[model samples]
Target: MAHITLPDESLPGIVGLFNFRPETTGALQLIAETLLRGESSLTSGERELIAAHVSYLNNCHFCHTSHASAAMAHLECDLSLIDDIKQGFNQIEISPKLRALLNIAGKVQKSGKEVKESDIEAAREQGATDREIHDAVLIAATFCMFNRYVDGLGTWAPQENEAYREMGQRMAFTGYVRYAEADL
Candidate 1:
């Protein structure tokens, strides 16, 4: 149950909140679309991974699970990838650039100032462009806000991973803006 009387109580997480305040949904969705689905050197999967990682660090189950599912959809991988990321991405064989960016994202989840000069240099050394780094930070920061919004409101989420798998496929193929409008 949500802390407030959302318009559609059954809709989980941010979706229910969006229904409660339709006016804010467009801006939020636009931010999501531009940051995660927009043209960038980083793949959508990588962006979603950053979002998931930050959400995980925050212990926001809804954001973590949803973004992890989206990451899986974009990467076309199985649940093992999600498990690897949750267990610790360092053990996985992801690109060095992504690992470096994930490091930055993790630091940002704690505090933006936690990102050090050495972190930026490490990402750059791994061939991460300024835009990619920027996006990674923005994604992390945005997800922090989003995770708070969802969990703070006490919104509900489906317990099963299958629900998120369907949501993930929709997010990956439909994009955020359209999905927001459709849901509205």
Candidate 2:
């Protein structure tokens, strides 16, 4: 059950919240589309991974699972990769640039102040451009707020992975703008 009576209680996580306040959905969806689905040096998968990582750190189950599935869809990989990310990036075979960005994201999850000059240098050394680093930080910071929004409202999330997988496919293929437009 949610903390308040949403317009569609059956809808899970942020979707239900979006229904509760239709006016805000466009802006939220635009942010998501631009960050996750927009053109950038970072692939959609990498951005989704950063989102999943921040959600995981926040212990926001809905955000974590949904974004993880999206990441899986973009990467065309299995759950094991998501597991590797959750376990920590050190042992994974991901690109050094991604790992460095993830490190920056993890620090952002803890506190904006936690990110250091050395972290930026390390990411730069790994060939992360200023834009990529900026995106990573913004994604991390945004997801932190988003995670809190979902969890704070006591929105319910489906436990089954299949539900998230379906959502991931839709998000990966259609993107957020289309969904947001439909809602308007």
Candidate 3:
């Protein structure tokens, strides 16, 4: 059961209908909008990768699995990359730039203050533009919040792989929020 019972069909604020309210929903909508819009220079897949990486670091299984699926859908890369990164990215086939970006995200997960100048410089050396580095940090920071929210509320996620895959496809294509239809 949800922490709070919201109206059926209502996309509650936070995950699990806790404090179902418009402002919270609006915030969630805006976050999703910004992520999907790719307001930063990072590709949609890279953004999702950042989210997944943070989720992994935080050990938020639901967010990690869901975002990993989303990343695979958008990037069209091997899903094994997710497992690879989870196990060890140092030996993975990903580019140095991606490794540098993940390092930044890892630092954010450890603690925002832990992100050092050398991290930024390393990313720059790997050819990450200022915008890309900025977006990497933003994505990491945002996912840290998202991971805490999901785990804090203990939201029940759809467990079936098929369900997650479907969600990934829909979200990658149509995004998180959709326009409301006219009432009959």
Please, what are the lDDT tens digits per residue for candidate 2 over residues 1-184? Answer: 9999998899999999987887887889889999999989999998998999999999998899889888889888775565666688644457999989999999999999999999999999999999999999999999999999999999999986666888988888788874545565
Clashing pairs in 3: none
TM-score of 1: 0.93
Compared with the true structure, model 3 gives a TM-score of: 0.81
Task: Write down the lDDT that model 1 would get.
Answer: 0.87
Q: Write one digit per residue (lDDT tens) for candidate 3, span 1-184.
A: 4454555423322444434554465556567657645466667777777788888899887677777778778878655555755785544356789889999989989898999999999999999998888888877888888877776755566654454675566667777654232210
Please identify model 1 stretches exceeding 4 Å from their true place.
90-92, 179-184
- C-alpha lDDT (0 to 100) for residue 82 of candidate 2: 57
Native-to-model Cα distance after best TM-score fit, residue 109 in candidate 2, in Å: 0.8
| Model 2 / residue 14 / CA error / Å | 0.1
Q: Each candidate: what lDDT?
A: 0.87, 0.89, 0.71
The residue-by-residue lDDT of candidate 1 on 64-174, one tens digit each, is 888888988998887556667788775446799999999999999999999999999999999998888999999999999999999999999887677788888887878
> What C-alpha lDDT, on a 0 to 100 scale, does residue 138 get in candidate 3?
79
TM-score of each: 0.93, 0.93, 0.81
**How many pairs of residues collide in model 3?**
0
Would you list the clashing residue pairs of candidate 1?
none
Error of 1 at 48 (Å): 0.6
Model 2, backbone clash pairs (residues 3+ apart or across chains), number: 0
Task: Rank all candidate structures by their lDDT, best first, as comma-separated numbers.
Answer: 2, 1, 3
lDDT score of model 2? 0.89
TM-score, candidate number 2: 0.93
